[model samples]
Target: MSSEVWFTVLVLLVGVERLAELVVSKRNAAWSFERGGVETGLGHFPAMVVLHTGLLVGALAEVWLLRPEPPSVLAWSMLALVVASQALRWWCIATLGPRWNTRVIVVPGLAPVAAGPYRWLSHPNYVAVVVEGVALPLVGGAWFTAIVFTLLNAALLRVRIRVENQALAGLAA
Candidate 1:
């Protein structure tokens, strides 16, 4: 198959995967709401959505516009990193279980989750995110997309982590 066809297939697969994540996050959000958990990051949700959407759009534009021909070795390496990041991301979700809503909802008196990837990094999911943000775009030789999204994500995560930490603190106290 042509690279264009491969790119289309990859994009479709990512879209489907993101849809699945939304479904899971929505269900988890409902569960948290039923349990009287408080969500603290409502204000950032829209920005987060926009940023993620931009990442996809920018990646596609880069692939078609700049059309940098990457070495096969680099392409395959980046592709492997993308897959690994997904695995790590799902591991985070599975470990967190119902507590893993996309929203920052805290249930008081539950020890902050420390299982799975969280055992090492305080934000393993972010690690996967950082990796995937760069890897996905680079798979199509979209260096600009990777760099832009990485910078945006870093800024966004700074605010997100602060908000989430404050919320979790309320539960811890």
Candidate 2:
């Protein structure tokens, strides 16, 4: 199969994975909401959805429109990084369990989760997002998409992190 075809297949697979994550996140959010959890960082949620959607659209556009032929070594390396990022992303999800909704809702008296990826980095899922944002686009020679999304995500995360920290503090107090 051509790289373009392979890239399309990869995109479809990613979409399915993301759909599954959304399902899980919805259930987690419901659980948290039932326990009187307060969601913070609402502002970032819509932007995140747009950014993720853009990643898919931008990647396909690059492959089908620009058709840039990246070096095979670089393409394969990026493909590996994308796969690795997915692994880490899911690891963060599994580690957080029901506490891992897409929204930042803090359950009172639960004690901030410190297991798995949380042991080292405070926000390992964001790390996964950063890696995958760049790696996925690079696999398809979508440099513009990668750069744009990375910068946008950085800006969004600055506010998101503050919101999350404030929510956690409220829970602590």
Whose lDDT is greatest here?
Answer: 2
- The whole-model lDDT of each prediction reads 0.86, 0.89
TM-scores for all predictions: 0.95, 0.96
Q: Which ten residues in a row are the worst by lDDT in model 1? A: 2-11
Please provide, for model 2 over 1-173, each residue's C-alpha lDDT reduced to its tens digit, 9 standing for 90 to 100. Answer: 98888998998898899999999999999999898888878778899899899999899888889888989998999999999999999999999899897788888878887889899998888898899999998898889999999999899889888888888887668
Error of 2 at 126 (Å): 0.3
CA shift at 95, candidate 2, in angstroms? 0.8
Cα RMSD for candidates in order: 1.1, 1.0
Model 1, residue 103: distance off in Å is: 1.4
Candidate 1 per-residue lDDT, tens place, 69-95, comes to: 878888899999989999998999999
- TM accuracy, model 1: 0.95
